[model samples]
Target: MSKNKAKKEATEKEYRKPLIKRRKPNRSIAGDIALYLFLTLVAFVMAFPIIYAVSSALKPLDELFKFPPTIFAQHPTTDNFSDLFITMGKSWVTFSRYLFNTVFITAVGTAGHLIIASMGAFVLAKYEFPGAQGFFKVVTVAMMFTGYATAIPNYIILNKLGWIDTYWAIIIPAFASPMGFFLMKQFMEGLPTSLIEAAKIDGANEWKVFSGIVMPNVKPAWMTLIIFSVQALWNNKASTYIYSEERKTLVYALQQIQAGGIARTGQGAAVLVVVMIVPIIIFVFSESQILETMASSGLKD
Candidate 1:
């Protein structure tokens, strides 16, 4: 009877347990607060220029020229945008033409860069050739030299090719970006070799392997490359090769507006907002996607 009672007691104890337990966070509350504060501060510092532009875009002339410059506007107005369009209408060249040029250059340059960079990176990462190692090493070293360093040489080459003041001047030279190639090569390295081998076993040629198999896999990397290329080409002055007023990019036109004097501060601020919007939109939407893809790309079999 005592043993029977003991078994009953044990059964009751086993059935009386909770389904889940909550553990305390690994970090102390104070530490968590400090970390959040630091991150917030860093974000504010980085976003200062954008915040200033947005605020100034809404501010009146008197507030914009306030002795103690403020980030927040007191009175908001859309006069700057209105005045900007009016001035643009007076110009012989259409404002739409400037917008079209920027969009066209950015699109063509980005697409060509993606294709060329991906192909080059694929070869550098996967294919073994006599001088492939040396070539990739040279590319890596070349990235250390900024684009301005080669501006004079590029001007000479473009002049000789009869591409001066032409769309080709901007589009042609953009295909050879070493940074894009390097980024793609690194991302491609993380891909599984078995997939490529399996594609080959199925009678897929080099082009098929690169396009059908490889391109689909490293999407995040290329999407990231899109972000970089868009930002670069969107802001490009094309000042060196492009001499015609109508051929100038929206960025150059914005600079011209900003130089018109202190009276156009609000309009210049409006210009800044317009120039920054596209890249910001691209980044905000794709950043989470990039992180998720990078996580999955690390899985190997």
Candidate 2:
């Protein structure tokens, strides 16, 4: 009798349920289309500058320098790039040398910044130490100021230490970014304390826990730090500290080319396009990781 009753209820439940999932309403479909259109418009607006740079770089001299300039190229050619190489060949410093300097500075600075900032974050976010609160507060306060604020004093100290005109002036100062440290600290705050405790119970030291647990977990934060460090170091002209053509960054060299009259404009646009590539690549990968981390975090609004 109980089996019959259960079978009857199951039959009724199956009868009430649909075999297929319901399709979304026309209103929902319309909303999705509108959202995608809006996003597409926004993306185009943000990308216009880079697009224009590449277009202008490929345009013939006549088209690139037209009155009330155009956004699209008329006669696309590689003359601008050829001319740029020719100009570089005539200059005292080779173009590749400038490229190498910028690459070295950016790579070293970004790596150093990630290590220093993440370590600082671990200490401040996880550990209990005297003056830790005050130290973090100082870091927070320092974030209110940009790198420009310290340029004068930084130059003075570097001059005293003879790091002036050396890569140390850029690399060492970059390692002490307050904003990166603070950003990492905030990201680390979301991490679980239990993991660290468990690691300690397993007889792991601070370094082991930091390397094995904290760094792996905070991949998004450090990736974001990489973007910040690269942008800063990549754009660094530092004309004040760096005087020689040998030490000057690629962007600075490009800036000089861009400052020339209409004749150099095509190559200038080429330079701009090249300079923008690395940052865009960094941003694309880091953005995906950051989004993934945020989704998995399961934080409530």
| Global lDDT of model 2 | 0.85
Off by over 4 Å in 2: 1-43, 66-70, 291-301
Q: Which ranges of candidate 1 are over 4 A from the true structure?
A: 1-27, 66-70, 289-301
User: lDDT by residue for model 1 over 55-169, one digit each (tens)?
Assistant: 9998888888897998898878887788788887787777788999999999999999999999989988887889988888788789879999999998999999999999889
TM-score for predicted model 1 compared with the true structure: 0.84
Q: TM-scores, in order shown?
A: 0.84, 0.82
lDDT of each: 0.85, 0.85
lDDT (Cα, 0-100) at 133 in candidate 2: 89
Model 2 scores worst on lDDT over the 10 consecutive residues at: 292-301
Least lDDT summed over 10 consecutive residues: which range in candidate 1?
Answer: 16-25
Clashes of 1: 0
